[model samples]
Target: MSSATSLPIIFVEEGALAAANLSAAHRAWADANGFTGQRGRLLALPDPQGGLAGHLFGTGPVADRPPLVAAQAGAVIGPGQFHFQGASGDPTLAALGFRLGAYRFDRYRAGKPAPVLDLPAGADADEVDRLVSGAALARDLINTPANDLGPDALDQTIRSFAADRGMECRAIVGDDLLAAGFPMIHAVGRASAQAPRLLDLTWGNPDDPKVTLVGKGVTFDTGGLDIKPASGMLLMKKDMGGAANVLGLAHAIVSAKLRLRLRVLIPVVENAISGTSFRPSDVLTSRKGLTVEIGNTDAEGRLILADALALADEESPALLLDMATLTGAARVALGPELPPLYSTDDELARALMAAGTASDDPLWQMPLWSPYDAMMSSKVADVNNAGTGGFAGSVTAALFLRRFVDNAAAWVHLDIFGWAPEARLARSQGGTDQGIRAVYGVLKQRYPAA
Candidate 1:
């Protein structure tokens, strides 16, 4: 079995026999072994001592995979110092996936976690440092179960993160929630002993291009009055995935010091059942003074996020982004690997798509279709908590939140799985940072100076 170590890998390509000359040790070996060098294949090369010269992996024609491909490749490669020698054999993907694959939830134990992969040849030292640090930070946040990662825990994490970078950090907890005028956030999280909190961290000069990030931080969701079944609750630990992803994005932004002024808003809560828990059909007023009729208590992620997004939009940040594990329909539409994104700006959508493709964090654009607006219309209030039958659950959810951000210049809503369902080459099954790298790429490219 391969242990966590750096391993060198190379790519092999097929060429014309009589038309071209191929004389490298790799090509010679491939010819003899009948290895056509297809995509994502790995073959062991000779070390002469046979101890392991390196890895000869195929990535089809160009020998390139998305950065997300790093997960599976990292999983299969030997865990020691190794680098890629073939086409674009830079260690970016390997390092990205290696850090991601190394994630594990061992919070209860005293055991030390996996060590960081030392950079191999061809890996950009600075880039590897930034990505690995961010990936590790995201994994640490996700791997912690709800038991220890409740609202207050997330608050502390964000505080430390902000302080480390010399950014401003503030959190509104419990009764302070009422004082802060975030009544909805207070109502949703009041049931849990852990006080519900809204964490805000801002970096960069106020004059810079404004970028706002909002993440759903439901530390655990028990469906409130509309409780989920046992199987559904099994993975409730990952309910804070959106929050984890935001931290991932923040890490990248701060590490690279992207030119834009970045602001992060996370509403941390645990949708627990208690005598004080809000019930279905109960009316609650948000920070913006819009009364929301809770149609289904299980649809709580949006509730908490509403207050955060309103807070974010109040500034009319140049870019407003909120990410959440908001709907099952999104997963059904795009599966776990591809996240569904809702946006009004076509150019922004294009940029996000291109960034997703280039970074290997692919995103699919789903319309905030105006027609679906009627589906969420509530008789008594501005909007219903959920759709009547859940035909376009993702669309309806995005529409619901859309009401809160009318003030923002540009807005994006990501309904992401944030968890990998199974392990593929360079990816593993568990709490994953879905669509994170792509968003980072998009934001950094749009505003490159920091």
Candidate 2:
């Protein structure tokens, strides 16, 4: 939680000797000091008193891919105020690069020593605030184990976050879920002692355009009766990634003080196997009144999201967005770097795509075709939680959720991995921030303050 990690970050470009244009001072330093400009090279310049003077890092000498300049020093660098001591006065590019380089998630253990970064002079304080806080929350949530981060803990985190912001919060827990008409949420969460609940928090003026955000909060996944292998269960603690992402997104929205009224909904549960666990053959009625046949006991994310999305739909919000680590198929299709986005509005889709590109948060849009509608067919219930054939599993899931939302002017569903496949500079190999920036960009432009 260091406020400003202002560490000096000077970049040395490689191949100066081979190039035609080179400064004598820069060339002299490079040749004498053996500065090859290889990525992530850390060199410290000390003062006359044997203290630190400034720090230097190596950046790959690619002209086209300048944004990735900070990839070398991101999370790997220790906490401090980082500065680009290079001659390039491109502060915006420097800030963008440094911001991308400063992310880290050391939840399993304490993060080792890395230089703190100093914020750039006149950096976008608001944007930086949202990015760091939201990303930290996401990482913490994804890094904890299921035993520690179950339904109750997830709800508690949300309550704590809401209270910190002075936002109003309400939760429908246990059988109260049934009484409150969140049967699916209960059915999915009822298996755990943590007791499933639908958490709703409101912020901003009541009369403002409602912007309801929903996230799947499955704290762990045993895959229910279907039970995944040990390898699959290893990372199941991150099943609540949807909830984490939503709360993370809400953190950004609230911190930025966006114009739209905000509401956050998280249906917290652990899809553990027990006699009480909902069965694959069983059918359950959702809050939206659509009866869903449980196609697979493990397909529990949709169950919780169904109840929450229905509630969001009821608000008739100006915009509705839901994020989940819902399918491996999506990961197979897009890998961990890009999340597949499903949206009903074309303009919104374009805007979000542009926003993602501009903000370094990339998302690819998948169609919400009506033809895939029948993939979720069920003989007894209105639909099955999963499609019979898994050809387009991600699309079918989106189709299943679409049943509950017909009124939202702009609705977007993000099937996010929430975990990075490998280390990518600021994005360490652990829990990662997928769409927070792109969504923030879109929201900022949509409701720019008057």
Best by lDDT: 2
- The whole-model C-alpha lDDT of candidate 1 against the native structure comes to 0.78
lDDT computed for candidate 2: 0.79
- The Cα error of candidate 1 at residue 357, in Å, is 0.3
1-450 in candidate 1: lDDT tens per residue? 123554556555544221223347656776677666565566766755767666665555544544545454456655456544445344676666656655555667754445445555566666666766675666667767887788877888889888988889988788898898898888889999898989989998788989999999998999998999998888788888888888888888888888989899999998999999998888889988889998999999999899999999898888999889988889888888888988978799889988888766789898988798788778898788888866989999999999889878889999988776777544456677776777888877788862
lDDT of each: 0.78, 0.79
lDDT of 2 by residue, 1-450 (tens): 124434456666554333423346444655677766666566665555776645556665656434545755664566555565563335554565566566655656686655555556656666776776787788778888887788887888889999999899998888999998999889887888778888899999888889999988898988988889999988788888888888888898888888889999988888876779899879999998889989898888988898889988986899999999999989888888889999999899889999887666889999888898888888999999988777888888888888889778889999999888687755767777788878988998987665
- C-alpha root-mean-square deviation, each candidate: 3.8, 3.3
Error of 1 at 187 (Å): 1.3
